[model samples]
Target: MLKLFSLSSSLSILFLASAHAESQVQLSHVPSQSQVEDFNEPRGASKGVEARPILVIASELIKYFEGWYPSAYDDPAAYCTIGYGHLIALQACASIDLGEFARPLSKGAGAALLEKDTRTARIAVQRYVKVDLSDEQFSALASFTFNVGKEKFADSTLLELVNDGDFDAAANQFGRWIKAKGKVLPGLKDRRACEAALFRGNLQSGKNSTFDRSDCAGLGVASGAGPVIDIFVGE
Candidate 1:
């Protein structure tokens, strides 16, 4: 069940500074069927690498894998995350001031945050990727960059091979990122595999049967203070 907490009056002082900076989208209703249909339609890749955006299906993939907490929760890496895995701070949710945050957020509000986060991921891919890509390939890389963080993605052998236009080798690099909090998490392995498959145009899942793995089941642990994800690493 979705957990909710009433905002205590004492938190007003804490809320003053951040309330203006946080997501203000109050979703009162779900997207219409037509809206979903439009989003699902292929936005098509740009001729240049700098302008490409992930397809709608790619964003949905990120959303499905990320934790759905209308109320903030401590993520594996110890970040205070809320609304489809959007990380904020390490502080308790109550101590963080989110203006108008009514505790449990609606699915629509959560999705809005996801959409916003994906844009940053998309920009990272566009900025570093030099080769032209199919919609699926760009989407796959965008998802990878989103989870792994832009700094790591930028320095990754995966990015090196991708910019070199050696896609097959790049596809294998996803498996290398299967550890989090300095331990191997089983969940990260499958996530990497699916992402690899998606880059190879063979991705399929229960939440989605669409166009994708590097199954890193036997991968060794890597050291990290954060989640298997590195989004906060260089930020």
Candidate 2:
């Protein structure tokens, strides 16, 4: 009877272990943090997306808007500008080791300066955005931040809309920023349209498909008109 009891006890233990294993197999696995985040993205945004490195294409697009000014010049806002809209005071430029102040910059030098300036924008964008973004989208936002400055971008309705995944609404918000110092500038209007097109994934070869030329018509404000620096400075 003792031997029979021992065998029965062993059999019961094995059955219990088997049942536990089966229950485990039937239970759903918990998702990881990354998985949960990806699942929560807006329908049109990419899934399992990672931050993209700044590519040449993005650099080119930004360069088209900033324009390369090797010599230190005053921007429309009166900021001492050099090497692709890099705002530095003449005094500050003279103190920096990066390049000579008031000297003609080479294309390579201008590109390098642009890369340095854009890094700040990229970092700001990464900090503000929680959802995953495509390379083009990231690039467009970075470019916008580069132009508008991180402080304004941080406080903007555009950034708010973008963070909430309302990209179309955010794209529309770009056009509202065309004014400078209480006046609507034609050059800014053109730039904002291009930026909007880029944000909406509607830009082709750096041109806006449905851009209304009527705003800057006959003003010679071509698409991607550089920086509008002259407007603010009255140069």
Candidate 3:
């Protein structure tokens, strides 16, 4: 009887151990659809969905512009410096569904740009654009304003009307840049069209998108095949 009882006890222990292992294995199965969705969302939503990493997107966008296009990297007042930075700002308008700021220039202003300062241009962008953009938008706009100045863009009918909520008309107005100094300038026309396209939210030019997780170095910002920045304090 003792031997039989001992064997029964041993068998019970093994059964319990096997059951526990099976339970643990079941618990470790693939995450549910909702769980996966929640994990993938940008930081800042409710439970499950992580908040969006807009700022990181903005940061990477700005960095991309700086690295890829430097000619447009001037202070407010330069001209013909069109670069990736300008492209990012122009694209931000569309991402947020806002209007583009289109302004002509005077010859006297030439390359005497905005001195690489961000304060004035940022204020102008916020005031005139009427969209609450991320820091990347602001930074990109500041760069644009640095190159073109707020007055030039703000005073234009295209931007003014767009701010008034006429998107179709505003889009049509982009084509007006087909001429310069009483003559058609293919380059300026192309530039204007490109800017308008960006304002339409096409990231083909790589504006407003986050960098590769592997590319973001020392930013202390979370990244992976997952969201770019896990948190944003806002600016």
Relative to the true structure, how large is the alpha-carbon lDDT of every model? 0.61, 0.58, 0.37
TM-score to true structure, per model: 0.65, 0.59, 0.34
Candidate 1: misplaced stretches above 4 Å? 1-51, 204-235
Could you tell which candidate, 2 or 3, scores higher by TM-score? 2
Error of 1 at 202 (Å): 0.5
Clash count of each predicted structure: 8, 1, 15
Residue 172 of candidate 2: its Cα lDDT? 68
lDDT of 3 at 178: 39
- Among the numbered candidates, top lDDT falls to 1
Model 3 misplacement above 4 A: 1-120, 131-148, 206-235
User: How much is the lDDT of residue 217 in candidate 2?
Assistant: 24
Candidate 1 C-alpha lDDT tens digits along 1-235: 1232334544665686456433221111111111122234455322233435676656666666675678876554345667777665544555777655547888898888777656656777888899898887899888887776666778777888899998987777777776554444455666666677778876544334432223322333323312333323322
lDDT of 2 by residue, 1-235 (tens): 9999999999999999999876543221111112122234465353343434564545765665566677876544334667766656433443555456556778898887777656656777888888887766887788766666666677777788888998877766766655445456555666667666656665554243222334322232234422232221221
RMSD of each: 12.9, 25.8, 24.9
Query: Between which residue pairs do clashes occur in model 2?
Result: 76-229
